[model samples]
Target: MTPTLNGPPAPPADTRCDRIDRLRAALNRALRGKPGVVEYVLAGLLARGHLLLEDLPGLGKTTLAKAVAAAVGGTFARVQCTPDLLPGDITGFSVFNQKTREFEFQPGPVFAEVLLADEVNRTTPRTQSALLEAMAERQATVDNVRHPLAPTFFVIATQNPVEHHGTYPLPEAQLDRFALKLSVGYPDRADELDLLAGAIGDVSDARAGAPVLAPGDLADLQGRVARVAVQPNVRAYLVDLGRATRAHAGVTLGLSPRGLLIWQRVAQAWAFLKGRPFVTPDDVQEVARPVLGVRLGLAPDAARFVLDQILAGVPVPV
Candidate 1:
């Protein structure tokens, strides 16, 4: 359950959305020319789901993650995952304390409000599995004891798609945990030139002047996202779409029941971002690609085509 904020009550719903819009603008500034990427990332964040960024190197993946952490005014940590990294390193381990005459639990980077797992696929499977519980349960079990993570423990993991030389591909179960996976493709010529200018100059902090929403307030916004109504007809449309994926010839494995819930949450967030109180079919279609494409097993190009077919085949409920 999402913990309630103890301070003054959260601002009204409109105020909260306004605050979110400010953060979105800041992210757009930080990641120039990728408004769609920024929107998807924001949706994942509001849905309280972990994100997987699969893109080439130096595409501002880390920069986007940092900008999010900064905009939210949350603590951020980046783990440069490697083959030798141990589960203990990500989740931390108990150390013998001579003064206390007992083992003392030392927390790891996973305790932060926002964690960036860079080149996550490069790490061993064992180390990769360390995040499963944390991502799913918002808590980590170490030394056979349960340790609760922060209420807003969001993860932004990045992996390189161009390289397969030394990487452990994430299993389906692990991939399912990510709410959405996206690529920050090369910018357009105009955006590229503007980026070059920013490169030569001292780029200002993206969130420096922006109004920073308190952590608790952001949590309240997420709660509001959860409450975003999904009309019955739209809900049925989601189920039909899921069934279509299962029947697709190219798909060896289809989205699971859990995937449907994640899809709804993401759609709800999208609707909320669009200033809507209820989810619409358009919202679902807008988010279908990133939400479903990540979980499909087809080739990257094929996945896009299949998604388009799935959407086109499904009757849009009025």
Candidate 2:
């Protein structure tokens, strides 16, 4: 086929798109030495899905959420889960108004654009349920009145792995709600040294950089991500891969339909971040470890083994 003059060539297969480049720079300051993770996080973000970060403390989980919120130029609220934390603390409460002669609903931390659900499993099941409806529907029905959240209501949830005392485990239902459960595993030695050097001087000036995106940009990104293309055979592969997980011998529980749908969305985000407009089997495979592995009920060590096996053998419908 003859090419037309004055037309730009298609982008390289492996270029981080401009928006993703901006996204990477935005979080690199706070999230040091986790470029791979930053990419997947963007995948989750563009997919319009919640994130569950499971790792040891002090690895920038809280900071990651804050940086993402700042990067997107959205409101940020932190919810510290405690044993005594109640559902009302999250979904807000209706207070009586004497002057107006009516009860007015006041929002809680959940009303923000990006909410950091810190130490989520520490709270009781009853209280955790407060997020179920909001995370799933992006709206909370409070006092029988449905309150719509901001269009980009992203939840970055975190939990401590070593510290489990007095912590309630997140049931499968809620765990399944998360699009991807990622861990910022330990940083490399050179990166750790870079961290130490980066902290040698005060850096408040770095935090003051103007946001690369407006609040509306994030919403636009979400819509654009939705417009990304996906093929039918790839869709079938996603379904088959998810079905394999449920049917695995070592696997205790498999990912549900919701999980497959969330994976599909995350795959789109992955492609977008990689500067592509179409989903590939590699996108699904790259995300399957984090997006699907967490849902598998294998023991921690066994989980890794099983994931490896799953990845090694899956016939990616090329």
Best candidate according to lDDT: 1
Off by over 4 Å in 2: 1-17, 200-209
Residue pairs clashing, model 1: none
lDDT of 1: 0.87
lDDT of 1 by residue, 1-318 (tens): 222232223224583356887888889988989998999999999999989999999888888988888888888898999999999899989999999899999999999999999999999999999999999999999999999999888999999988999999998888899999999999899998997776676666442334368758779889888877787889999999999999999899987889999999999899888876678899999998889877886777999999999999999999
Q: Backbone clashes per model, in order?
A: 0, 0
> Against the unseen true structure, what C-alpha lDDT does each candidate score?
0.87, 0.83
Question: Where is model 2 poorest over a 10-residue stretch in terms of lDDT?
Answer: 1-10
Q: What would the TM-score be for candidate 2 when compared with the true structure?
A: 0.91
Measured against the true structure, the TM-scores of the candidates, in listed sequence, are: 0.92, 0.91
Position 215, candidate 2: lDDT: 53
Clashing pairs in 2: none
